[model samples]
Target: MAVLAQDGGLAFYGEPDEAREWFRADRIEDIYLRLAEAEEHEWAGRFGAAPAPAPGPAIGAFRQWVLLTRRSLDLLTRNRLTLAVLLGSPLMVLAMFAVLFRPGAFSPESPSPAATVMILFWIAFGGFFFGLTYGLLQICNELPVLRRERLTGLRITPYVLAKATVLLPLLAVVDALMLGVLRALDRLPAMGWGTYGELFVTLLLCSLAALALGLLVSAAVTDPAQATMALPMLCFPQVLFVGAILPVPVMAAPGRWLSCAMSNRWAFEGLGHSLGVERLWATGRSPLGPPLLDSYGDTFSRAPVVDWAMLGGFTALFLVGACLVLTRRT
Candidate 1:
C-alpha cells in the first residue's frame, strides 16, 4: 500500500510515516498517480507469477447454469407488459371469432363446417397473433443479454433450453385460458378422448414452433425494434397459405413450398384433422372453409383425429431448425 520513491539517485522513503510526509506536501495528483502504479505493481507481485488460471470445475458449472437461468428468467420477466398484450390479444381475437359464429346465427344443420372455420380461425389466431408476438418478443428481448452471456462463455443451447422450459408452462396456461373462453362461447368442436389428446399435442407443437421461430428471428436481428416490427412480415404471409382462404392446389409451386414451411398451416390442418373433419385435407383445403357447409351439413361431429405423426414431424422440424439457428448461426 506504500510506495518507495527515488530521489538524489537513491531509494529514499524508508517508513510509512516518511512516505506520508511527502504525500501531504501539497502534491495530491502526483502522489495518487504514483500510489496507483505502486498498488498495481504490488497486485502483480502477488499473482502475476502464477502459471495458470485457477481451476474452477464446480464453480464453472454453477456459473454456467446460473447464467443461462438468469438470462432465461430475465427474458420472461422483462417482457411482462408485452406478454400481457400478446396473451390478451389472442383471447380478444378468439372472442371476436366466436361472436361471428354465434349460436343460431348459422343454421343448426351447418354448425360443423361453420364451427370448423371458426376453430381454424382461432388456431390461426394462436399461430399468427400469439405465435409471432411471442417469438418476436423472445428473440428481441433476449438478444443483448444473450450477446453478453456468450462473451462470458455461456452456451446458447442451454440458454434456449431453459427458455423453452420456462415458456412451456406459461404457454400451457395461455392455451387453457383460450380453450376455456372458446368453450364458454360454444365455439369449440366436441371431440372424444383420442381427438382431444391429439388436439393437445398439436397445440403444444404450434406453441413450440412459435417460440422457436421467435428465437430464430431474435438471433438474426441486431435491433430489438426491428425484431418487433418483423413479426407481421413473417406472420401475415402464413394466412394466404393456410389452405382455408385459398386451397393449396390453387397456390403456385413456390406457394406450395412456402405453405409447407409455415407452421400455421400445419397447425390448422392438424387441428382440423383432430376434430374428425377429414374432408379438410382430403383435397388440401382447410376443412374450415367454403365447402365446409357441405361436409358437416348442420351440427358438429367428431372429425377423424389429426395425424399425430405429421404434427410431431412439423413440431420437431421447427424446433430443430430453431435450435440450430439459436445455437450456431444466431
Candidate 2:
C-alpha cells in the first residue's frame, strides 16, 4: 500500500498492521525532503485507512493564559528598548511637565488655572500614550505565529487576555509613579493619600482603555509598520476631543457629543473631579479660573463613578473588539 501525504510524502507499507505501527511511530521519514512533511491524514489514508493515536486532552484556557503570559513577559523583558520605554517614558514626560508647568499652579494663593488644567490633561494623555504605544505592536508583530497557533486549538479569549494580563500591572505602576512624582515635585497639589488613590484609579483606567485600543489596532493591521502608521490617527482624536483644549460644553453641538465618546475625556474629567478642580477653579485667586470652569459647565459635575464606568466600558468594548478582529483575521 502507498501512503501519500499532503506535501507529497510517500510511504510504502507491506501490511495493515505494519502501516498502523508506522502511524503509531509518529515518524514519517521522507525519502526526499518533501516526503518528510508529516501530516496525519497521509498516515490515516485518504479514506481513513489507519487512525493515529489521539493527542492528550486539550489544554485549558487558564493554562494557555498562564503559558502565554509567561512567554510574553519573557519577550518584553528581553527587549531592553521596550522595557526602557515602558518604565522611562513616564519619567521623561513628568520631567517635561515639571519644567513646562510652573510650580504653585495648584496652590490656593494665586494659582495658575491654565497650568492646573494642563497638568491634569497632560498627565492623563501620558498614561494613554504609554498604554497605546505598548499595545500597538503587540499582536501585529506576532500575527504569523498567532495564526499558526490557532490551528492548535488556541482560544482567542485567552490570547487577548494574556496580552492584557501581562501589561496592565506595568501600566498601573507607571500611572502611580506619575502622580507621586508630580506631587513630590509640587507640580501637583499636596493631597491626601485617598485623593491620590482616586487619581491613580482614574489614570490606570485611562491606560487600560488605551491598551485595549492599541490591541484592537494591532490585531487589525498586517504588520508593525502599519501599526506604527496608525499611531497618529489614534492619538489625534484622543487629544482633540478630550475636552482639555476645548471644554466639552463650549464645543459645537457635534463636538460636544463626540467628546463623550473619548476615553481620555472621561479620564481627564475623573482626574479633575478627584482633585476638586471645580472647587479650585471656582475659588482660586487666578482671575481666569472661574471663567474656565463656567465654560466647562457640568463636565466635572457628574460623580467620578460615572467616568469610571465609562472608561471601564470602553476597555471592555475595545478588548472584545480585538478578539473579534483576531477571529476574523484568521
Candidate 3:
C-alpha cells in the first residue's frame, strides 16, 4: 500500500519501519497513514485467500430451515404478551366451552344433540382461529427484513415452510389440549384413543389450512394493521358458512355455495363424523336430535377422510397462493 501527501512527500507501507518496504511504489501518505495501511493489509492478508465454504444443496436448505425456525421461535417466546395470548387462548376458550356445554352431550342414552353440534363446531373454529391469528402477524411485520434476506439468497419456499415448521407444532399442542381438556371435563364423550386421534387430526388439519390462509393474507398485506383489518373479513365467512350456525342444507343457495369454500365446514363435519354425530342425532334420546339431523342433511355422513382430504387441499392451495403473493411482492 502507498499514499501521497499534500506536501508531495511519499511513504511506503506494508513494512516494519526498520525493514525494506514490501511494495514497489513509495507514494504513501504520512508515516502514521503508512503504519495504518500496513496494519490493515497484514490483517487482511491472513484472511484474503480463504473464502467461506458453500454448503451443499440439501444441507443449505436444512440449515436455513433450522435457523429460520429458531429465529421465529425465539421471537415468539420472547414476546411475553404474544406468548401468553397464544397459549392462553385455548384455556380461555376451554373455560367458555366448559361453562357453555353441560356434561355428557355425547352420552348415547341421554344425549343433548344441540350441545354436541355446538361443541364440535366451536372446537373446529377454535383450531382455525388459533392458526389464523398466529400466522397473520408473522410475515407482515417482517417485510423489511424479509426483503433484505431475499437479496441475500433466501428461498421463499423454505422461508414460508419455516413459519409453518415453527407454528404447526404449537398448533398441534393447542389442538390436543383443547380436546383433552374438554374430554376431561365431560364436554366430549368417552371415546377411545383412536377416536381422539381422528378428532385431533381433523382439528390439526383445520388449523393448518387456517395457518396457510393467514400466511397468504400476511404475505399479501403490507403491514400488521392491514393484517389485523383482514381478520374479520377472513373470519366472518368461516363462522357464518361453516354450517355450525346454520346447517348447510338450510343455508341460502349462495351461502351453501360459499360454505363449500370454508375449511372449517370440513373440520366441523369431520369432528361430527368422528364422534358419529349423525347417528347420535338420529337415534339418541333427545327429541332435538332428529330435527337438527334433518336440518344438517348429509353433512356428517361422508367419511372423515374426505373432509381430511379437503382440508389438505385447502392447505396446499393457500400455501401456493401465499408463495405467489410473496414472490410478487418481492
Q: How much lDDT does each candidate structure score?
A: 0.59, 0.86, 0.86
**TM-score per candidate, chains pooled:** 0.69, 0.88, 0.81
Candidate 1 structure lDDT: 0.59
Worst 10 residues of 1 by lDDT: 4-13
Q: List model 3 lDDT by residue over 1-330, tens digit each.
A: 333333333433233432224332354333445445564455345334544446444447778888999999899889999889989888898899889889988898998887888889899999999999989988999989999888767878878989998999999999999999999999999989999999999999999999999999999999899999999999999999999888999988999999999999999999999999888877888889888898989898898899999999999999999888888888
Q: Output the lDDT of residue 5, model 1.
A: 36
| Residue runs of model 1 more than 4 Å from their true location after superposition | 1-55, 58-67, 74-83, 104-108, 112-115, 278-308, 318-330
Lowest summed lDDT window (length 10), candidate 2? 26-35
Candidate 2 regions with alpha-carbon error over 4 angstroms: 1-50
lDDT of 1 at 40: 35
Tens digits of per-residue lDDT for model 2, 220-263 = 99999999999999899989999998888878899878888889
Whichever of 1 and 3 has more lDDT, that candidate is 3
* Model 2 TM-score (2 dp): 0.88
Give Cα distance to truth, residue 162, candidate 2, Å.
0.7
